[model samples]
Structures are given as C-alpha cells and as structure tokens.
Target chain A: MTDRPKTIDEIDTPAVLIDLDRAEKNIARAQAAADAAGVKLRPHIKTHKLPFFAKKQVETGAAGITCQKIGEAEVMADAGLTDIFLPYNILGRQKLERLKALHGRVTLSVTADSATTIEGLAGTFRDAAHPLKVLIECDTGGGRCGVQSKEEALALARQIDAAPGLFFGGLMTFPAPGKAAQAEAWLAATRDLLAANGLACETITSGGTPDMWRKPEGQVVTEYRPGTYIYMDRYQIAKGAATLDDCAATVLATVVSRPTATRAILDAGSKALTSDTLGLPDYAELVGEAGARVIGLSEEHGKVELPAASRLKVGDRVRVLPDHICPVINLYDQVYLISGDRVVDILPVAARGKLT
Target chain B: MTDRPKTIDEIDTPAVLIDLDRAEKNIARAQAAADAAGVKLRPHIKTHKLPFFAKKQVETGAAGITCQKIGEAEVMADAGLTDIFLPYNILGRQKLERLKALHGRVTLSVTADSATTIEGLAGTFRDAAHPLKVLIECDTGGGRCGVQSKEEALALARQIDAAPGLFFGGLMTFPAPGKAAQAEAWLAATRDLLAANGLACETITSGGTPDMWRKPEGQVVTEYRPGTYIYMDRYQIAKGAATLDDCAATVLATVVSRPTATRAILDAGSKALTSDTLGLPDYAELVGEAGARVIGLSEEHGKVELPAASRLKVGDRVRVLPDHICPVINLYDQVYLISGDRVVDILPVAARGKLT
Candidate 1:
C-alpha cells in the first residue's frame, strides 16, 4: 500500500492497462451504433467486471448493463447500477435466494432456455410484489445454451407468462457471429408465433460484439448486448469489429529473459495474459513489435517468438494486446486506467470471479 | 455471509471443492516419495495458492515452498512462511524492491536466466547485511526461461559469486515432462562444470508435477519442487501421476439448462473451470458420468456432452475434474475444504492473482 504505483511506467509489470481515452471513444462508438440502430445498448459488464466502466457505459446511453452471472449483477447493484439483465439460466436454491434478494434491489431481468430454470425463478419470486421479467433464450445459431426451436422458445415464454410472479419479457439470443440474418429471421418468426398465440413480445434482444455494428434489417431486435466492445481485444480486431488502435486494454510486461535470440521471456504468462487463444494462433499480439508474437505461455512466463531482425532484449517493457479482453480483465484485481503514458486512476475489478 | 453452506450438497454452484482426506494423502505420499529419494520437497504453492495447504505440505516434511512470482511469495511470507524459493526471472525495479523487502522478512532465493535479471537483483541487494541467494536458471529442455548452455550457467554462477551482496545458490530448471533423463544430464553436467570452475553448487532443483514421481538416478537434484501434486487434476491423471480417486479438487456445478437431449449446460464455464486444454480434447471430464465431457465453454456456461444413457437433468448438481488445477484455483477467491460430503472450512486462495 505504501508503494502504490502512480504513472504507467511506475506500475508493476504484467499489469492490465486500460487506455482511458481509447475506452471512452469505444464506449461512445458502441452507444452511437446502438442508438443509430434504434436498439437499446446494454453493454455486458463481464468484459471489464468493473462497476466504474459499467457506470460509464450507462452514462454513455446504455439502457442497462448485462451481467452473465447473478453474482456480477449483485456487485453492480451494490455500486448502484440498476436495470441489470442476467442472460444466464441460473439454477440452485442458494443462487435463487441471492437472485431474489438482488431483484428487490434493482430492476432485474433474467433469461431461461428450459422450464426447470423458469420453475426455479417462479418458485423464488412467487410471493414478490413485482413480477420477475423472464426472457426465453433462443439458440438461433449459437449451439450453446438456448431453446433449439422457436416452438420451444414459445413454450418457455408461455411457461414464464403463466407462472406465478413471472413476466414473459420477450426473447433473447446470443446469436452466432456473421449470422445476423438467420438470427433475425428465427427471432422474427418466434415473435410472430408469440403474437399469433396472443402473447405480446415486448423486447427481442440479440447480441455479440462481432455482430453489434451489423444492424438487423428486420428491426426485430429491440436491445443489444455487446460485452467486449468497450475494451476491444485482438480477437475483436481479427473479427473486423475493431482495429488495433481501438483496443483499450493491454498487458504491460517486462522482458525478464532473452534466453535465445529469437525468444524473449515476459514476466506475464497465462496468469497475467491468459491462455485464451480464441481460435488465434498465439496468446497475444505484441504492440509495435512487428512479427513478434507471444507463442507460448507457462503459468508465469510468456514465450515471445521474435523476428530475426527484432531487437527486443531483457529489461525492455512491452505492451501486449490479449486474445480476449473479458477473461484477461477477470484475472486482475485492479486495472491501471491510463491516459496516454500517465495512469489517472486504478479501478478495482469489483465483479471479477463472480462465477455463481 | 448469513447463508454459508454447511455441506457440499448445500453449497452454491460453481464452487471449488477440495477433498481434505485426499489432499492429506497426496501431501503424505509426496513427502514420503521425497524422503525415499533423499531429496528435499519444496512444494510449489502455485497449484493451491493457499497458505493453509502450503503449511500442510511443510508440516508434512517439505523443506520449503516455491512460488512463481514475488507477489505470491510475499503472500506466503506474510502468512509466516519462512523459506521461499521463487523460480522466476523477476525483472523491473518495483518488483525488485518488493523482493528485497520480502527478502528482509524471510529466507528468500530467486532464479535468473539472464545477466539483466541478475544485474537487477545484485543492484537491489548491493548494500544488504545478508547476501541474497541467486540461482542460475538452466534450460533443461523445458524451452522456457533459462540459460541455454552449461557454459552460460557457469558464467552466470561466477557473475553471481562475484557480485556484492549476492550468493551463487546452485542451479534450478523447470524441465519438460518425460524428459527427466535429459534434464538430469544437463543439470549434472552444469554442476560438474561449476565445480570445475571452483564454484561449489549447493542445491540443484528440478520440478514438474508430471515427472515428480520419476526419481533421477544421477542424484543431481537435491530438492524437488512439484506443484499440482497437492490436488491432482485430470492432466495429472493423464500423465499417470494419479488416478481420479486421488484428485482432491473438483468444481461443483449445477445443470442450469438441458436445452438439447445430448447437451447439458452447467453453471461453471471457462471463468470457473478455465479453458486450459493441456492438449486434452475437452475442457473437463465429468465425475462419475462416464462418456460425458465438457465440450465447450462460454464465459458463464459450460456445454457438457452427455452420454445417451445419462439421466442428467436441469437443477442436478455435477462435479467436474478440471484439466489443469493450478489456473482453475487461481479463478476463485476461496475453495470449500470438504471432508466427505461435509464442508469443513472455506480456505481463502490467499496467493491468488498475484501476477506481479
């Protein structure tokens, strides 16, 4: 505590550096895209896991903040963030109790892809004065959690509508990247099916950072949730959603060893940069170091493969653009918020490790 | 805090469960192995990251504990750990200052693979009353940080011996798994080379959980620093180090959504279980559910591919054996110490997220 770093250079190695100016531009850019599409922007806090950024997104015209877990939402709610949408099928009695308690403190909404999840939600909120908004999660194209078909989504929507102390808050789907048309069509058909069944679909939400800027021509999506847009990563850049300059967060590491002419070891590794390749060839891209990439990572050391002409040496500091920003942020307790080369503030990742 | 779980069944989802009985057995088994081999067991705390477990290992006859970073060692030192070995090429002035302060508090030894790291350490401890023990890290086929050759190791050893306020403490290498003979040969050759140069190498150390049980016939390694043995994971099982019954840590997750007949989504995902494949085909192997494997992971959900005959359903709890336990333990703040089905205590991961 006595030797807390002030400037970026003074901060310790393997620290997460959030470029404040770049992050502000990214936030404004995302909000502008959502506003232009006439869809509400609900930036997911799972990326930063910091209430400060979540508040910033909300201040930048985000309708609300989306959290992947109820624990994250609880942290946000503690920081006075209202209107949190947890688009996850939360189970278990312990979490439901927490969810119910959190529901009392904020305008909370959750998603369900199965009847069992809805049942648990209804059972917990049965005696509540306000009905819990439950959205039916649709698969669309992402083959993860969600109802397989629109009929299943409708059935879950009906289940939510009929259940005690539950409100059917339309549909939500984490669609596959670059498959927006198929997702829009599937969601629109589901919306029509619900409409024909005499159930009004109030809000249809679809989200993914890769497809955030690609507005649906069908105008079926009422809200958008983009988690990684605030701190664009190398994966986001590879996906063409952002450029390297748009990347707001980077790992600052020191070259501890140049064991080989072609290899330089960094103090940061999987523990600092994370081993999330995200389908990329390496762990991260070295900023300003052409042809130099983090090829391998042990828990505490990153193996950077330098180009033949590269002059990287021991004691040299380098900034790295991680493959994914969300998990990388989750690895740190606090991130150095820097404006250019000077660190303005240190933000604690309050919602980090909120798995449940 | 009011609803703290008393039992494993009552505990919340996405929680790390450390089987106390199995962990005890693991500690005793590793200690006995080291005792039989006539080598000092310096268990690496990077696996468990808990001082309680580190103390358990030391109490069970470990010589000391090894930490990957100074920050981790600082946590262990603050927890009253006396002798600490940090097998990392620590660079930067801030970390060196912390290292010097930590050296003042405990018996600290660190490794350096290059002249730059050695220079930093020497510069920091130039006027200290007690000289700092510095080991030359040798590349024993691990392909990570270390001097490339025995000649280089001798050069660094001489440099450390000549440097003021620094003691040339033997050699250390994090060898590649299944290359024990090669690593031993390399370390022994370096030891001979140092002895020929009038430098008495005191302690030679080499470690990796995968090759922990394999005794070096050359007897060059005087101390063994094997992490991950405290809580054997699936990777250890695959490496033939331990069986499933020997695994002490398991992630307890709930089946939040059974959207498809073959796919069940668990509350635990990469954020809880981690995405470290370790060359394994899947994220994790399901406990007691044969043929079921965690196929994919999102930030908050794990997509488990269930066997056709499996009767897993939503709201049902499932235990998962992570591929790698070290990083998995880093993801949580605390883990439930369980004795059979009962939760004995909640051990805080005190050294977690100590990236610096």
Candidate 2:
C-alpha cells in the first residue's frame, strides 16, 4: 500500500486493469510447458484480443495464434500476424466470402466436423491460389461440435483429402477437463484410421486450459491451443490451472453505495464483470476482501453482500478478479495495462465484438 | 417460415434483430399505461442505447430519459436529449468532474444513498452557476442500493438541501418485483418526513418492469422509470409485464453444428447471447423449438440440447430471445432494425460500452 502510483488515483471507476508482469509470466510459463511437452503452442487470441499480446505470444515461441472466427483472424492479420487458426465450424455465404478474403492475407486454417461445413469451405476456396487447410474436429468427451466416432472422422478426412482445394490438416478437439486421455485415444484411433485409408494426417491439435499442462505426450497431438491461461480467472483457479496470483486481469470498480451495514453496491455489474459465474456463488473474486460475495447483478449494478462488521464505504475502489475472464474482456472496448498500479499501456480489444 | 424476408438470408450469423413493429407496440403500451396511472414516463435508455430510440421515447410522451452512467448521458446529450436523470451514485474525482460538466449542458439530476457520495457531488458543484438536483435513493424492498429507512433517506435529503450547490430533487428506488406497494409506502413516509422539514419533493421516481402496470396509484409517486418495458425480456414476460410475443429484440443465429441426434450447436454463445440468465436455466429463450434448452455456452458456441425426435440441423437459422435484454444489447456494437424480415434501418448502439 505504501508504494502508490499516481495513475491509480486517476483511473475511473468500473475500469479494466491488467497486470503486465503477471500476464507475461503466465504466457512464458504456458510456453515453457508446451515446449517441454514438445507440442506446438498455438496460443488462442480470443482471450486477449490485443495485437500487442498476440505478438507477445508469437515472440515467446508460440507457433501461431488461434482465433474462433475469421473476423478475429482479420484483426490479427491486419496487425501483421501471419499464421491464424479458426477452430470453429464457420458457415453462411457472407462468412465464407470473408474467410476467403482472410485466406488471401495469412496462413489460414479452420476446423470442421460435418459434411455441410466441409462442402462450404471447399466451395468457397476450391479455385483459390492455395489449397486451404481444414482440420477434422473430433468429439472427445466435450460433446460439442465434433465428429462422433473414428469412422465418422475418417470419412470426413477422406472427403477433405479428395476435395479440389481443401487439405486434410489433421484432428482437433476441445476436450473436457479430465478427458485428455480420451482425446488422445480418439485422435490416435482416428490418425490410425486415416493412415490405413492412405490419407495424410498433418497436425493433431487438442486444447483446454484445465488440462493444459497435462496434454497427452508423444505424437498423438502435435499442437495445444490454450486461451484462458494467459489471464487466469477464478474459474481457472477453481479448476486448478493456476493460483490467484497467476490471474493477471481484474476489474477496478468503486463501491458507489453502502445501502446497508452488510450490503454495498459496486459500479461494475454484469456489464463489466459478466454474469457467467462459472457455477460460483459470486460473480467475481473480490480482491483483498474476506467474505465479500457479489450476490447479484442488474444491468449496471453489482450487489456485494458483506459480513456484518465489514466497513466498505462509498467511493472506495476495489479490484475484482472476474469468474470468467474471456467474456468480461469482451464487455470492454479497451483495457488499461498496469505495472504495479502505474498505468503502462492501454490497448483496444481488437476482436471484442467480432462475434461473427 | 413462408413469410421470410429476402434480407433474412443476408444477415450474418449471431446478429441482433429488433422487430420494429413489436418494439413500437411495447413502447406505446408502456407509455399508455403510465399516462393512465397519472405518472410521468421517463423512459430509461439503457436498454436501447441508440439515439433513434431515445428520441422516439421522448417524442412519445416521455418526460425525460434516465441513464445509469454519465458516459451514456453524454451520448444522449450529443443526440440532442436535453433532460437526463442518472439514478446511480457516481463516484471518483474524474466522474464528479464529468458530472459537473454534464450539468452545464443539460437538466441533470442524480441519485445518492450515502454521505460520501453526497459530499463528492457537493464538492464538485459547490460554486457552480447552477445547483445540481440530488435525489435520495430509498430502499423499499429491493435492498440493493438505497437508504435502508425513511429516516436515512430524510437525513440525506436534508444534507442535500443544506448543501450550497445541491437541491433535494426527491426520492428514487428500483423496487423488487410486485413491491410497488412497498415503494409507495416508503416514498409516502419519506415525503411526510421531508414536508415536516419544510422541503420540497419535486419528483419521486420508482422503477422496475416487473410491476410497471401496477405502479402505486397515488400522487405520492410522480414518475415511473421502466427501462425494460420498451423491449421486454423473458424475465419480464415471466413476471406478467408482457407476453412472449411482446419481446422486441432477438438474436438471429445459425445452427452451425449438430454433433449428435440430441445435441445442436448455434453460432450465438455468451459473446452473442449473454450468460446472464436472470436466474433462468438457459441463457436465452430458444425460439421455435419445443423442449430445447441452451444447455452450455463456450465463448463462440451455444450448445442446445433438444429431444431425440427433434430434427434440428446445420444451417437452420433460429431466433433467440435473451433472458435479459439490456445487457444483451450492450454487448453488440449495432442492431439491425427489421420490419417483418427485411431490415428497415441499421442503428448504432451509440452508447454501447460507455460503462465508465
């Protein structure tokens, strides 16, 4: 508390502040883990949309950047990042056209699990100068968007290989936590199936921050994509990804109302900290407080219920480590990067509303 | 499905579409209800941040507009809104200075529930050319952010009246659903206390869409501020404020993947349809699908688990009515105003992300 920064007092209420030192350390630690595992680290830029951090990940030995949409890849490409991986099933005519335009700029790759998605990508890029790389997204206990069985994956891979302009990249899956073994089994079984069918398996990318450090070793999965590890949150802490200190981003909010002795209101609410509690009781981890729970959120008011003896008053600023950092970052247009409370830099959330 | 507009196919996936006809009906119904109840309808523009809608409200018998933040008010003023009420306690050196500047441009009043907040406002406007109106935020039964009792409210009102550059505006409260009686009693008791102290209660503002139709029928409350009534949400519909057909805004998303016979994935997720479920099980009301629930949200994917017999497939576009509309609108940069299925106009969410 003694080493106060002048900028801390000037920061407005309901602002986002990132600790650069902690973020850099998190990035380096994830990179080292991927290096030791001998897996290519394709850091997901969906968490931190700033090009400054995207370039930082590449400079720290990341193979490329991973984004969920072509819009995000376009932002990264505009910032001069060459390699981009979109690990989602992109459809619709406008999106495919935009994806084609993005392919003209960078080393682009996408993931798909269905014939409709494969046909869409092939139709858009069939006559392009370069054959587009498409990965088969496999269902590995996540039960989300991926092919169900090894036979289904092999069928998709053969179709992709036979396509005029699409290259069967490999297998990709976002495994549920504690299912890395299942992901490895699924990918290895599919890779074997592809090899038996004389189809080339180029890269196997499996990812999730919960089991990020425990990616199955050997040649089963070649690359790992982890987004939330860059700025861990309460959800990550609960998932045992990192300690609370490993969390780099926090919301700076002021207690605007002390309605009662046990209840205070913060300027930040669902609009700032996001209401995705990740199954936690509190919307966020109230920094430097004991037994303070953000109980509810209206559009603009965060209701924090405290203990009877709590002395939190109006105009007092407190930092909140959001329960889920990705959506919270999506709420703000820009975030202030701080080094020990001294504002270091402010970066625009480039891919913030690029939801399409 | 036969009446589908030609423009429906052109809208990108995960786009917000405002049914202009439905929105107009909702706005007219709320305004007529306020007029019937003999209260001023000062519509809160936090839900639809577009200037076009705010102007529409004012033109349709609204006394003024209510916004939560000074940033939102600044945008409204830029759009030629002359009178604005910010019913949240603003804090910090930067915000108070901004509030003082806003007071110079328009008829501005704010709500306060603490002495510290009052002092901050008093200090900022101590010698200004105009006296700032300060309303005592009273806690009826919501218990979120307001003075706990009539005594505490009167104390704050007296403090505001005694301050050099502050005027006691009246009382304000965001009462809990079906607590209009409680709000009426609280405001009545506070008004009696203020009258005994020879103070004027100019405008008593009570707000909440849950009991908008039953705003306490008395001269005790002069103004009603219901933000969500303009574009009712699923929560409001459940509270009997409006029907499902009364909902104006909906997210249009394409089913990009059907991983299993019972599992479907939409392009909208937490980033498109917010994770603030408003205590609902699903993040949003899945339109046109019986027994379909938005079971899970991962940044770019909304997993909708339906019945085994359901025939949902990829490339099928569906509409999602969010559980809450205000924060959902805040997430987008602009909205497409549609008449039937054709886009009539495109409005910028001008005050989107002005969460200072």
Deviation from native of the Cα of residue B246 in model 1, angstroms: 0.6
Score every model by TM-score. Answer: 0.99, 0.97
Per-residue CA lDDT of candidate 2, range A15-76, in tens?
78899999999999999999989899999988899899999999999999999987889889
**Candidate 2 lDDT tens digits, B135-182:** 988888987888888888878888999899999999998888788897
Under CAPRI classification, how is model 2 graded?
A: medium
- Regions of candidate 2 where Cα sits further than 4 Å from its true position: A1-6, A215-218, B1-6
lDDT (0-100) at residue A102 of candidate 1?
91
Best by DockQ: 1
Error of 2 at B89 (Å): 0.8
lDDT (10s digit) by residue, model 1, range B243-288: 9999999999998888778888888888998888888989998999
User: Highest TM-score: which candidate?
Assistant: 1
lDDT of 1 by residue, A185-301 (tens): 999999999999988888898888999988578689999998999999999899999999999999999888898889988888888887788889899979999988999998888
